[model samples]
Target chain A: MTNAERKRPGRPPGPSDTRDRILAVARELFARNGIDKTSIRAIAAQADVDPALVHHYFGTKTQLFAAAIHIPIDPMDVIGPLKKVPVEDIGRTLPSLLLPLWDSEAGKGFIATLRSLLAGNDPSLVRSFLQEVIAKEVGSRVDDPPGSGRLRVQFVASQLVGVVMARYILELEPFKSLPVEQIVDTIAPNLQRYLTGELPGLS
Target chain B: MTNAERKRPGRPPGPSDTRDRILAVARELFARNGIDKTSIRAIAAQADVDPALVHHYFGTKTQLFAAAIHIPIDPMDVIGPLKKVPVEDIGRTLPSLLLPLWDSEAGKGFIATLRSLLAGNDPSLVRSFLQEVIAKEVGSRVDDPPGSGRLRVQFVASQLVGVVMARYILELEPFKSLPVEQIVDTIAPNLQRYLTGELPGLS
Candidate 1:
């Protein structure tokens, strides 16, 4: 055995090692079979760890998924900052806050998570994350008509999801080549409309 | 062997059987490993056919991909009908014409194609489809600033892709539950704006 292997012989490979192994296995299984179909026991078996260890480390499957995907920031981090701005200004603020992340080094993980969601692995998790976390948080802060807040949040999610998929994931051009400022300038007003604008057909 | 198996045993299992088997294997591999990584030889090997047979049947990898995914309608069918309408009407006409395809029986193939694209299999195919096929065809029909038509088509593509992801794939609520007519009504004007309206920030 190598000196490094001999030194760590009886230590049970450390807590972080076990945690990392479980996460790696979970990510592979989730990517292959999707979030709904992969189970904790299966992940444990693949990782060669006890099932209880998986739960002990990650708490729930959803929590484990979040860990495996490495979602960089809380949705509220994006939504919370915008709450201080006037509702009218949020159109501009929304893209300003969110778009920078897509360009940053940290955004790669976010992109992977988004890609996995697009791949139809645990779509319910994405839906819940958007509705329960992002929409609920932002909706509580925004002053809109009763029950309209969720719809507004959904619209915002759709626009943002589309932009990321086009510009970052699919790399669809002119979008792929355009300066970020130009994209921000163009999309902000539309996002503003979705956030606060009236629906044309609905009362 | 059963009568059905006996009848098909000789003569290379007939044309349709060989073609269907090749396509099925290609779809599975493409979905699993993505387009760039999957090879014709590998697909043939998995399908239990000679490599030459795959080439003889499908002509090229691109053609095989097109056959496997089965994009339901020529994009021109969507673009062609809109051409008869005034250029100004194309925006509103677009969603009216194309969104219904998502909910149709044939749309299953489209959804699969989109999922594969989102999964990062042969993104170039989608890019070329959008640029060479959809944009080229649509741009020829629309009157816009010399270089801006491509950008407009891209914007429309982003919106349509996002809506389908949210409503069909991600199942974001409100969008998921709302009637399709309402979706068309709400989004048609925005698509129209992308199609013909003055972009907010561009000079």
Candidate 2:
């Protein structure tokens, strides 16, 4: 320990370090083991810590699961403004909103986690994540009627996911290497369709 | 066995039984392990037979993997009619078109594979499955302008997956139990929008 480190405070380490450690270990273990099979005690063991340490830190596995798999974006901050963005302008704004994240380090973590679920066999984890996170975070923001939000949100989610699969996961050649700006230009309008376009024949 | 049957049958369950047994074991194992990890030798050991038996029966692990996951639905049979559905009507017909099989035994295998993937952590599996199986099947049928056909196909896939995530995967309360017809009625128009719609502000 550095001479200054030993002199710091009453708790030794501040409260955040324990929580962060648990999440780091949880992500590794959950990736290795199926989510359903990953027990709290197992996560505790993986961390070389006590079960109480996990419970004290995360409370429940579901909550821990949520935290561990959290994407870097704070949905509230990004999406909240989207709801009020004159829904028409959303076509332009939505693509502009996601491009940087899709092209950045933090966004890659989100993409990796999303793509990982798409590649894994446990639909439960992906389903719940979509329901709890995607639905609540993205779907709930739009003021459309109850079910309308799902259609809008799901359509939007699919566009983003499809781009990820084609570009990152499947590594489709042109798209895989496309410059960030070009991709945004190409995909943004389609997303705009999902966000605010009208289907000619039906609605 | 009947006295005549036992005597008339080819040599008492010898090499023939081993081949069939190996195939059965291989099918189950491959379904569980995926093709990458399953080996001819593993199939032989699991079935308590010689490895050469696998070669005799299926020729290769790749062939065996294909056999294990093969479905009754002909890809053309699944996707062919959509070409006739007209892009406008494609949305309404989308769910009703496939939900029967998704509810069928044959469809269940595909669904099981899809469900397994949907449950997993990777988003790409669902994306690829949709692309490989559903999207390619449906999207190829929609002959629109460059981006529209692709976007239309992607939008269709998004709706179906969203429904599965809702009704099957997450088991969302009201949605989980809603009749298929109701779901079709509720969600199809949004799909219709993407299939044959004017870009909201573009038009």
- Top candidate on TM-score is 1
Each model's DockQ? 0.46, 0.08
- Model 2 alpha-carbon drift over 4 Å, by segment: A1-17, A20-67, A88-92, A115-141, A144-203, B1-72, B115-141, B146-155, B158-167, B170-175, B186-203
- Local error of candidate 2 at A40, Å? 18
Model 2 is docked with a DockQ of: 0.08
Evaluate all candidate structures by whole-model CA lDDT and list the values in order.
0.76, 0.60
Model 2 error, position B192 (Å): 4.7
Candidate 2 chain B weakest lDDT stretch, 10 residues: B118-127
**Residue-wise lDDT of candidate 2 within A80-140, one digit each (tens)?**
6776777557656666777677778877766666644544434455555555555665566
True contacts kept of 1: 0.66
For candidate 2, give the docking quality class from DockQ: incorrect
Top lDDT prediction, candidate number: 1
Model 2, range B36-69, lDDT digits (tens) per residue? 5667888889888778767877665555544444
Winner by DockQ: 1
